[model samples]
Target: MAATAVLQPYNEAQYDHRAFDSLMDVDESAYYFDSLTGYEHLRSGLRDIFMRHGVSDELAVALLHRHFEMSTNEKLVELGPVSSPWPIAAHEDSVLGGHILPHTWRVFENELHPLEFRFIPQQEFQDARKVQFSQAFFEDFRQYVKANGLENVVGITQLDHGRDADESDVQLMEVTHGRNSIMVPAVPSSDVSGPAFQTIWSFVEKQSSKLDADGIQTRHGLCYKASSTDAANDGIQTRHGLCYKATSTDASNDGIQTRHGLCYKASSTDAANDGIQTRHGLCYKADSTDATTDGIQTRHGLCYKANSNDGIQTNHGLCYKATSTNTTNDGIQTRHGLCYKANSNPTTA
Candidate 1:
């Protein structure tokens, strides 16, 4: 019997927008098949039909798995070919090989549609692995959401690779409110396959914050090798996900120099002559040696020594200039000949 001559079990009108919309309402439980044996039988039957129609086995298996996962009901059933005139059917109630069937089926006579199947070449599939994401895929997803009125809440569920060794990733994006979902290539079409999937994944991760439901969140930032001197001098940089520059510099002395952190010239010549002045702190002359009075005089009346001199000792005593040298002079004389009263009893000689 010719394949087209077979009577279609379901009506074409049954698989229209209404049927697709009905899919959005289906719960996750509908994806479970009755039994493993039943699933294998259904898969084998679909494989045979698909192969006979020139579809690759890998693609056939992938399509079948997707079909089963998105099926409105949980039962596994055998579906037969439809007649040429009405080759497509959307009604779910049909009996083939003593089993129930799905509401939609792609006819052998029709050209393959993107909505139904995707044929990725071996090289293309390999390329997708290196890619984390793609702008083309994002655009396609955006369009699909807009067209399907899924702008508000869209959920994407990634599935395992095919039963065979094919590592091609598959995902289904659906409107969370109803069963309006379809399987799409996890990576974008081959034309836009060079970008790593991580790039797009990150973008989604950052955008997820805006999503009410379980939508992907995308992160954003600048990435680049910063100029050794100034951030403003850094050249333009590009990244698929986010970009951020290294914010630290090699230490001048022993450790990393953070931005705006204290730093000094490390060269011995500069340190010996410049007296270890901080980039933004008080500058100490090289001749100063006293720890307390060795740097530039500050506003707090601390005397800074210029050439190792202790200067007037104002900390522990009161200085008083005497008319003449005498032990009765109420102040003790310092080695510099300045007289001052000590806080403790004065030492008399």
Candidate 2:
């Protein structure tokens, strides 16, 4: 609520009642009283009067003037302050980082979701016209979605409650999620029974559903990966069932697999052995060309080779550097002046 203001006494010497009389004739729908210099205090009381319960675009301007008179008339019954609240102003920032009545909000599945949204010009709020509200990602937010290759996001708003239809002024549910939900949230009012109060608060409360967070998401899991991580991570993250799509593929692999894989597992162990390799683990070959694909080489104490002329020869040079003058003979090597030859043929080794 706006803080109560410091009132000023009518100064009969400097100023006369003539100046205040002009304020009586102006209409209330869009009222702005002129300020005497250095008198910021006088503006607060008048400003408060304009900001009470939301004025609908459809409300008769004369009725609005009457309402204003009822609230501000000096001769009205002095029964003390009415059980009213501070008015919601267009530019005022709320504790929730948005407005009580968001600039533009959406409703889906009969639930209210207040958001800091905006609109494109049409006529006025009273005209049966349309506007845009942006969330998630879009080409450009301030521009009309139609202007930016998108259609308007369909939804509803309650101009009366200053909230979504589903949220009562005070929350009754005990929100729960470990430390994540124990924090206080800024609500419109604390009284649950308030005639026109609502909130988007966070509180500790028990949920009675048997399913986990997965169920509230209206999306089928096939489209996007739900974060087992953040509560709002690409999942049902808002009051209107704003679900971020799961990846088109189950990149998280949640509860989905090959149809054939599930069929075999359903059979009993006593059934005949399936004619397929059931072994499952990292498969490594004993001999994978005897070299790592990354170009790193490993070998035993002695090198080994497979030659067309010689099958699996040990202590052989698969590839080696020979820095010597060498000669070949019938399967024999002679001293420093080395000589080698095939056992059967002198031409090959």
TM-score of each prediction: 0.18, 0.13
Report the lDDT tens digits of candidate 2 across residue range 233-296: 3332211112222342232334331121122222323224432211111112223433342221
| Top-scoring candidate (TM-score) | 1
Write down the worst ten-residue block by lDDT for model 2.
217-226
- Model 1 lDDT on a 0 to 1 scale: 0.24
Q: What's model 2's TM-score?
A: 0.13
lDDT for each of the candidates?
Answer: 0.24, 0.20
